[model samples]
Target: MERFVNWSGSLAFDAERLRQPTSEQEVIDIVHEALDRGGSVRPVGSGHSSTPLAETGDTLISFGRMAGLVGADKSNGRATLLPGTGLAEAGSALAEHGLAMENLGDVDYQSLAGAMGTGTHGTGRELGNLSSTLVGGTLVTGTGAVVRFGEQADSAQGQTLLRAAQLALGALGVLTSLTLRVQPAFDLHRQNWMTHIDWVLGHFEELSQTCRHVDFYWYPRSDRAQVRVLTLPGDEPAISPPGYLKKDERGPSYEVIPNFRDLKFDEMEYMLPLEHGLEAFRRVRERVKDRHRDKVGWRVLVRTVAPDDAMLSNIRQPTMTIALLQNASLDHEPYFRDMEALFLDWGGRPHWGKKHYRTAPDLRRMYPDWDAFLTLREKCDPEGVFLNDYLTEIFGLQGAP
Candidate 1:
């Protein structure tokens, strides 16, 4: 058996075989063989997801060999990228063509397909998650058929399929290529500072609304927080209190948007209604201070994401996300589960790729188009060739091959 482990060293599993395919035909062939043998095929991309979405005891397909920019259209500001291409690599490639991703998460090591599939996002009141940038893509369905959505779609049904494919959690099929809406290469000015949590909570609304991007990390041990904001050059600088400025710099959008994460940690993030975000954070803070402060050595992250139309998107409406992170070497279950209860009371939805304790029934109630996505998944992969034990349970599927 071949062993696989995630970036954070949290989830690990063994597979019967691991196959790396360099072409679309090879992916189709792999699926066909899995179907013939009545086995399962799970796709792995950087293994950045802390969840068991990629766990499997059967065949594992890796797209690392089939990476890089496939094509670019400067006139349309669009680019087609191989699914395995890392966000950092894609950014540099797109820059060469005078293009860039509109927004990106603080971590850029995830593959394009992995980020899209998991609804990864950055902080901004107006910017949707990375999946929202997907305009089209091609996937090898369970039946060994090539399906195209987005720009290639010519009808209403095709467009609907495209929306479902936008964030299918790798349950629909294996993505071979993705077409994204890019923009002319641009630059941004980033500023970071440390402040009291009370001040951040009081002024967060003003900061988020006036800045292009804003996020913060609140330490449990100390009530203090570190706030970071990004703005396009020449934009009015965000209002700040005296002596809070720690670092100020300007660089290309790609370089400035992401922070370098050197420490590994386990994380559980939930998206809640913007209206209830502050109160939820207050309650979480109280609980952490009252109970879990001794065990929590990492900070809590708060960010916002704009609403999007993807069927399974976490942000159906404007959302505020609160993430609980702990050192990878420490046990995270007790603290995460305790915080999760608070999030659920506030109508929270889990980030698909992160650690969560929700089942199909719990998730179905959270997403408005849950049934619609399931129907599409069935149409695309009726045989369930892509579902492993973890996906099978969450999707509420009956037997796995």
Candidate 2:
């Protein structure tokens, strides 16, 4: 049996069984078998999520063989891909047809299904999350029913089904394939430099308005912020600075978007309302610097994202993301708990894939469409075969049969 461990070693579990499904029908059959055996099923991707959303002791499923671009319609700007395809592969495949995903997270290592299912997003004030690009997908429900939802929505049910699948977190079922809304290939002008923390907070609004993508790291101890900005490709006009202050990388969006990360750390991020962003950052920075100095080992990451309508998406409004990442060597619970408390007081919504402690009732108040998502989940998987302890607690689900 293969050992189950997350990328950061933050989450690990021993499962009763592991299954890899290669085709849509295979995924369906596996679901049927798991239900028959009265076992919970969970699908894992690159193990990139910091949360225990994927940890299950029974019937762990892998789509290792169910990967790659299955189809593409360049004229319609849509691409269908198997669930296990990685972000890097999806980018390359889309580029082949003069297309690209609208935006992508900094880490390009997550699987397409995993990223969308968890609401992974990139930093852009005018851009939506990865799930927003999910116009269609095929899912195998808990009862072993194979259903497909797509763009040419003939009914309100199909539209809601697609919306629910956007960020369902494996609660609805297993996603076999996804169809994304693609854009024409483009390039980016990425500029990065380390500046003072106060400088970043002071110019936050201005920075958000001018850049296509803006993200930064706040080292409260050093009182500095590593500010990075990506500008869309156009010869509009620019002045050059010395050495590494500005790197002009002009290529496909896929090539320029991701910042390769080698360090391993556990992170807790919250999606705060844009209006509440600055004050919340000030409070969290103070907590990191003054109250939790001994526990907070890594810097704070900040980014902005536009509104997305996915039923469970964290970015329900134009949101600002603040991630507190700590070295895996330290105890993150104390620091993370404190930070979450502060962010929540400011009306922040926890990123689904990151560390968060909010359960059903609190989460229900956060998302307006929460009830609708739960209704769909029940409708699709009454047996609760798709749920694990983590999901059950978070969703406040009834006891599994």
Candidate 3:
């Protein structure tokens, strides 16, 4: 039951006891056993994270073997599922019942629990992240106690648990199942293209406002992007894309197009803290073009998200995130230094799971409730079962066994 970790092709952690519990009782027993032996447990779902959220030095609980449509409520537009169920598989199953998730990330391979745990999302002005669609689920507490919570509950603890569970981080305990809100299945029409940074900035507001769902990618080495804008027809049953358009390639399905990785680009992502996203893009474009002057490759991509409290959500506010993929292999430190300066100037926050070289003090300034989040983690997982080297280096949380 052991396997090598394969999260986002970056780092790997060797695992012991990759348990796939098919029943809640099995999960409870495993938790109790771990507690008795003074061992820890980490629940892994699809290994899709860019961060080491699922890494544990003790036992690994993989949900892959415990998957399928558990139940659905057609009238209420709700579905309950096992944690290992893949997003696309669940989406298609829900579609057969005339239902779909309100939003989905670009990659469909992630499990429902893992996506919610990390706040995976897609672009839409009115829509929120996938975690927001979670109405309720069963959380096995750190003490191996099983509790069920949902949105419509009348109790105060239930309400608090529902909100907190939206981004539980798997620190609270193992999640056996989830109940998600669903919308009527709909068809999407997509358009893709390339544009100059100036034009994109000029119309960024209008573009974001107009589309039902829109996202763009600017190539690092080139002036073009495989941009896509999706729209749904009004007052009509959803129509499938024409055969020709449907045949269009879904470039690098699980990842952004890796056009200039060879450039040894040191990458940096800034969570732009402005409502009028176009202004941020315009500013970044001007600064980079004026300063670099053909010495670097610039690629600007735009995507949308609904807000959440995953601690790493880019759209925590009504915001836009503009990423700069620059050549860094030659002088990685200097390149990062320059990027960090500009990012801070833009009031940008780094993606918590990426390659930013910021320390805890720096991250504290970026997140308003950094200490409060730590307090929450302490309360939920005082034993530090979920702790890993990455967590220690980033947050400096010691005292875990």
List the candidates' TM-scores in order.
0.98, 0.96, 0.81
Of candidates 3 and 2, the better by lDDT: 2
Instruction: Assess each prediction's global lDDT (C-alpha) against the native.
Output: 0.91, 0.85, 0.65
Residue 300 displacement (Å), model 2? 0.6
The C-alpha stretches of model 2 lying farther than 4 A from their native spots are: 235-248
User: Which window of ten consecutive residues has the lowest lDDT sum in model 2?
Assistant: 235-244
Quote model 1's TM-score: 0.98
Q: Residues 1-401, candidate 2: write the lDDT tens digits.
A: 45799988899999888898878888888888887777788999999999998888888898878999988888898999999999999999888888899999988999988999899999989999999999987888998888878674567788889989999999999988889999888888777866677666776687788778888888767777787778876732242222246445666788888988888889899999988888888888877778987656788889999998889988888899999988887888888887898998888999899888888889989888998898999999998888888888888885755
Cα lDDT tens digits for candidate 3, 9-39: 5446777677778888988888888878887
RMSD of 2: 1.9
Model 1 pairs whose backbones collide? none
Error of 1 at 299 (Å): 0.4
Candidate 1: lDDT of 52? 93
The TM-score, computed over Cα atoms with residue i paired to residue i, of candidate 3 is: 0.81
lDDT of 1 by residue, 26-62 (tens): 9999999998988889988899899999888999888
**TM-score comparison, 2 vs 3, better candidate:** 2
